[model samples]
Target: MPWVFLVIAGLLEVVWASLMKESHGFTRFWPSLGTLVFMAGSFGLLAVAMRTLPLGTAYTIWTGIGAVGAFLVGILWLGEPAGALRLLAALLIVSGLVLMKLTSGH
Candidate 1:
């Protein structure tokens, strides 16, 4: 389904983003190559999902998913801050995405 593809693409966005950070401006060979491949795949899948899903709704979900995923990864793996405010913001992003999906007449 298009939604499945979109979710996968959103997850891939998270993967590529994490890999990109590890790539060290392309100085790290393996992570850089992985980043390039995953980035292209992520966008390709997003484009495919867009064929059936409304662009605005899909994009909002995609971005929301990416933001939350990245923040979680930063907190868990990268030693980034995990304060109450950060968690609240992440929750808000997820809530907004849910609201969009619930309200959209898909």
Candidate 2:
């Protein structure tokens, strides 16, 4: 339901972020178009999720997922640094998301 939409939205956030990097400040046509499409889809799904989930909880989880996903993409795909501290920060963001999920009654 809403959670499904929320997850999809978060994933789309990652995709759009990657596309944004690929877009080269929107000079590249195809990646720029893809970025716009996914950005819209992500926002739409986030709005859908907000109908049922608490606003802060849903937003935090969505951004958390996007941040972690984008960071991994940066390291693995784009050759960004995979330092211990960076990895640890990513893990902590994920842990926070899990803790929020577990504690929230919604």
Candidate 3:
């Protein structure tokens, strides 16, 4: 299903984002390669899902997942701050994503 593809794409987006950070501005060889591979995968799935999903909805959800996922990953694994305001912002992004999915009509 397109939704399934989209969700997978979003998750891959998260992986790519984390890998990008690990790449150290593409200085690290392995992480840089991994970033490119995952980025391609995420984009491929996104294009497939876009065949049916609305542009705005698909894009927003995809980026929302990436943003929130990367945020959590940073906090959990990269020693990034998990400040209250940052957590609230992530929560708001999630809320918006839920609303977008519900009203997508596809």
Candidate 4:
């Protein structure tokens, strides 16, 4: 289903983003290649999902998932700060994502 593809795409975005950080401005080899591979996969799935899902809803949800996912990844695995403000921002993003999905016809 389109939703399935979209969710996978969003997850792939997370993977690629993490890998991209590991890539260190493309100075690395394996991580840089992994970033490209996952980036392609994410884009491909986004295109597939877009065939049915509305552009605004799908794109917003996709970015929202990626942003929130990256936030968690950064805080948990990357030793980034998880202050109350940052946590609140992530929660707000999630809330918006839920609202967007609920309002979507698909």
TM values, all candidates: 0.96, 0.98, 0.97, 0.98
lDDT of 3 by residue, 1-106 (tens): 9999999999999999999998999999999999999999999999999999999999999999999999999999999999999999999999999999999998
lDDT of 4: 0.96
Q: Count the backbone clashes (under 3 Å) in each candidate.
A: 0, 0, 0, 0
Q: At residue 29, what lDDT does model 4 achieve?
A: 100
Which candidate model has the greater lDDT, 1 or 4? Answer: 4
Best candidate according to TM-score:
4
Please give, for residues 22-44, the per-residue lDDT of candidate 2 as tens digits. 99999999999999999999999
Minimal lDDT window, size 10, model 4: 97-106
- Shift in Å, residue 79, candidate 2: 0.6
Model 2 clashing residue pairs (backbone): none
lDDT of 4 by residue, 1-106 (tens): 9999999999999999999999999999999999999999999999999999999999998998899999999999999999999999999999999999999988
Write candidate 1's Cα lDDT for 6-39 as tens digits: 8898999999999999999999999999998988
Q: How far in Å is the alpha carbon of 91 misplaced in model 2?
A: 0.6
User: In model 1, where do residues sit more than 4 Å from their true spots?
Assistant: none
